[model samples]
Target: MSSRQNILTGSPWEDKVGYCRAVRIGNLIEVAGTVAIVDGETVKADDAYAQTKNIIERIGKVLEDAGASLSDVVRTRMFTTDINRFDEIGRAHGEFFKDIKPVTAIYEISRLVSPDYLIEIEFTAVVGEL
Candidate 1:
């Protein structure tokens, strides 16, 4: 039987919404949609690049807790309020995952949980033999 684990970031929303930041089932880890939220406040507000960077960093932490790394990430999905800012968002993503080169998709969304948020990202990772 496969074991399961839940990783939490202590976000109030996790409790209110009854969802964890990420879940690990055996070798696979699935991270929830993440934004540039720190200390219950949005960081980088309307900047897509900065927000993307922050969200990736946040996902990295959750992955670490789940016994995986960014290199283990096999896919990523990015949701942005403005597709025109793809250049900035893509640049930020490249800075982090350029080497790992995970499959990715960027979509223009009407909005996020917060209007101030410009980007949200979700990830999937498969842990390899250590």
Candidate 2:
């Protein structure tokens, strides 16, 4: 069996859900769907762009803990409630992975865990041995 390691992001969900922000098994690190909520509050509700940025930031922390970086990410999934916010969300997502350009998929879902949440993102990265 492959050894596993957990990655944390200092979010209350880490305690409440009894799960880590990310987990590393072998060369793969899978991150959970991270929302824009920080300190129990949504960072940007009106601005989909800002919300996307905030969500990615949380996911970034998980990648860091797994000894991976955004550049190492091979795939990503974004969940949004409104389809109209594609441009806004896409812009924000592009800001970070501009150079690396990970394969990404976005979906306009009915709702999220909370109404205030505008976006949630999950990532998968391949970790290389040092």
Candidate 3:
């Protein structure tokens, strides 16, 4: 049978982007790269730390919706506009995954879909007996 699928929260972008918050394929759950946007715009400008925290929290919702927690996460990918902000983003990333110690990669990008976004993160989790 096909794996169950669901959206974690009711974000306007879910329909606009045509993607779910998290999709479960068999035992794997793939989460979309989440930013700190609350409505249609970024909430805190230049606050990469807070933005990172917000993004991770939003991702938490997606993981929870799929019957998984952050501990289930096995991998993560982070995208940032400025490499210099790695300290801020890395600390935030570490705060969440410190216990799980999931494989992670951070990249510096020219820009994100939105200019205000400083950091974006996506996670891959294996639920149930991983």
Candidate 4:
């Protein structure tokens, strides 16, 4: 069996909560639920579209570090605090996966870890080694 690999972002929560940003085993990578947090604050706090876009871009980097790309993503799960914002969030998701069209699910939850955070996303991807 291939060895397991862990990807860490060194966020305090990773240590405090004992979780990393992502993990990869062979060709499969699972990125942890991600929030659009930058410099200790939520990005575009009130704009779901901007926050979703920013989150995807950050997730793209994490995937790249794990030897994969957004196109390699096979599934995505999104959680949001407002169902009314679905159109904006979906528009941002379509921006990246319109062609890739990965399987996905978006849920309108009551809240997130932070009140400023309107969404959190997770990704699963399988890719060949480079």
Candidate 5:
């Protein structure tokens, strides 16, 4: 069996909630729900499109740290506070995954950790031989 690895982001919530940003085992990497938080502040605030873009870029870094890349992503889950903004969110998502075409699901949620955060995303990736 492969050993487990944890990727931490040093977010206060990670330590308080006892969760890492991502975990990798064997050839699979699972990134935790991510928001557009940067330098201890939320980015893009109420903008779903920009928030989605930031979160995806953050996830990309986590994937790279786990020895994988966006192309290796097999699935994605997005949670948003506003379904009405889906078009914007979808556009941002398509910009990143249109070519890779990872299976994805977007859901409208009541809220997030912060009211300023409009979206949160999670990703699952499998590392294949390169």
Candidate 6:
């Protein structure tokens, strides 16, 4: 059996919300929805594109902690405040995933845990050959 492993980042919300950053079992890794917050402050507060990029970078580090790489990502789900920012969001996503080309979905949401957050993303990755 594949024992479960929780990839934790020590974000305060993790404890308050009772969830880890990601969970891995066997070869599968599921990353929780991530936003562009560092040191408790939102990154690129008003720029959707920059915020998306920051979120992806944060997700990248978490994925590595889960023993996976961006190339290993098979799918991604993104949620955003405004559909009008799709172009900015998509552009930032393309930069990280252009060659990897993971399956993706983007949805317009009313808001996030914090109003400062413009976007949130989740990832699914498979580690190693099947």
Report every candidate's CA lDDT. 0.89, 0.83, 0.85, 0.90, 0.88, 0.90
Q: Write the per-residue lDDT of candidate 5 for residues 1-130, one digit (tens) a residue.
A: 8899999977888988999999999899999998886333445576788888898888888888888899999999999999999999999999999999999999999999888888889999999842
* Candidate 5 local lDDT, residue 62: 85
Instruction: Count residue pairs with overlapping backbones in model 5.
Output: 0
Worst 10-residue lDDT window for candidate 6 reads 37-46
What is the per-residue lDDT of model 3 for residues 1-130, given as tens digits with 9 covering 90 to 100?
A: 7657875577787888787778887789999888886443445778788899898887887788888889999999999999899999889888988889999999999999888899888899998763
Residue ranges of candidate 3 with Cα displaced over 4 Å? 38-43
lDDT of 4 at 13: 95
Error of 6 at 125 (Å): 0.4
Q: What tens digits encode model 1's per-residue C-alpha lDDT throughout 8-82?
A: 999899999999999998898999998886333445576788888888987888888998889999999999999
lDDT of 2 by residue, 6-100 (tens): 88767787899898878999889888888876434446566788788887776776677787788889899999999899999999888998888
Clashes of each: 0, 0, 0, 0, 0, 0
Worst 10 residues of 4 by lDDT: 37-46
Model 1: worst 10 consecutive residues (lDDT sum):
37-46
Measured on C-alpha atoms, candidate 5 has an lDDT of 0.88
Which runs of model 5 end up more than 4 angstroms from their true locations?
38-42
Candidate 5 TM-score versus the reference = 0.92
